[model samples]
Target: MKVTVIVPARYGSTRFPGKPLANILNKPMIQHVYENVSASTLVDEVIVATDDERIKSVVEGFNGHCFLTSKEHATGTDRIAEVARNLSTDIVVNVQGDEPLISAELIETLIKPFQDDEKLQMATLKSKIKNQEDVTNPNVVKVITNKNNHAVYFSRSTIPYNREKIEVDYFKHIGVYAYRKSFLFDYINLPESILEKAESLEQLRAIENGHSIYVSEVSNELIGVDSPEDIEKVEKFLKAR
Candidate 1:
């Protein structure tokens, strides 16, 4: 299946305004995200979906493809749906604009499930949570999958409960996803479910609606820049690398 990676960027971040254009070691943040996704072997095209002209100019200056979207979007998924309407690709991957260190290998891994399963409608990545804090933290979304590796539920609370300390793995849901192009409208149009509203994890809508979302286990660490405090760490990491 042909895949197109779309990075939804907006300048009105409550925590960090003009975040997409913020420089990391002199290069813009959106450029870093674009470069990472563009490096993926699985994606055929990469587009930055933004409502601001400043973001459009930054992306265009780097010779990256960008689309101007409506500023009234309530969520990133809705923002990408507009861009998906204009594209003809078989698969659409939503790559977060804040994830400058997002793994290209992980992006490639996300697209792998679609290659063999025609029934798969959506897919996302998960990494093993090593500590009790991350497992319990509401900020870190947890994903529980069925025997066939399809997501059963997604929540902000620790899943499975570890009732007996049995040897089981706890996975934290990564904030990247790939969806079948045909299901874009269906996926977005579905009314917000109780699980989704409660957890604020949109993937729950797919689970609540009885849609199977394949989960790909990956080892790559995702570093996202969400606040001003994270910039120095990212810059230092980038400079060292």
Candidate 2:
């Protein structure tokens, strides 16, 4: 099955305007994400799905493929879905444009399972929470999975409630995801669910709709660029490397 990695970028950001185009070590941030994902041997194609012409131009400037979509999209999934609809790929991986330190190897790992499990419709990554305080942080979304690594629930509050205060392991959800072409459409078409609205998590839409999300535990030690300060961190890492 063919795999396509689409990095969804939007120029309008309330916190960091023109974030995708932000320069990191003299290169645009989107370029870093696109180049890293492109290095993945598992993927057949990489595209930047964006709503801004400026973003499109920057992507094209580096000879990378990019397509413009409707600006009204509420989420990156919606934007990538619009682009994937016209493609002939079987699997679509959503790689965030803000991840300058995104790993190509992890992208391969994200989609490789599709070859073995034909019934698997979706998959994502999870990291064990080493910091106890992060388990209680609202910004840190917690996920609980079943014995088969299928997600049971994802919430900002402490999952499984640890009411007994016993030692327990927690995993934080990573936003990246891969979906079968058919299931991707099925997901985008479904109305937002109550759990999704309550948690403000888009992935919950799939879980609430009775779809299982298989998660792969991965230790991804990288900083995601969210603002101008983040760029400095990315640059420092690159310089150190």
Number of clashes found in candidate 1: 0
Tell how far residue 49 is off in model 2, in angstroms: 0.3
Q: Which tens-of-lDDT digit does each residue in 129-193 have in candidate 1?
A: 88778888988889998888988888888897889989988999998999999897899999999
Among residues 3 or more apart in sequence or in different chains, the pairs in candidate 1 whose N, CA or C atoms overlap within 3 Å are: none
Candidate 2 accuracy as lDDT:
0.91
Q: Write the per-residue lDDT of candidate 2 for residues 1-241, one digit (tens) a residue.
A: 8999999998988889999999998999999999999998888999999999999999999999999999899899999999999999999999999988888888877887788899999999888988889889998889999999899999999987878889889999888899999999999999999999998999999999899999888887567877788888889999999
**CA lDDT, every prediction?**
0.90, 0.91
At residue 142, candidate 2 shows an lDDT of 90
Runs in model 1 with CA error above 4 Å? none
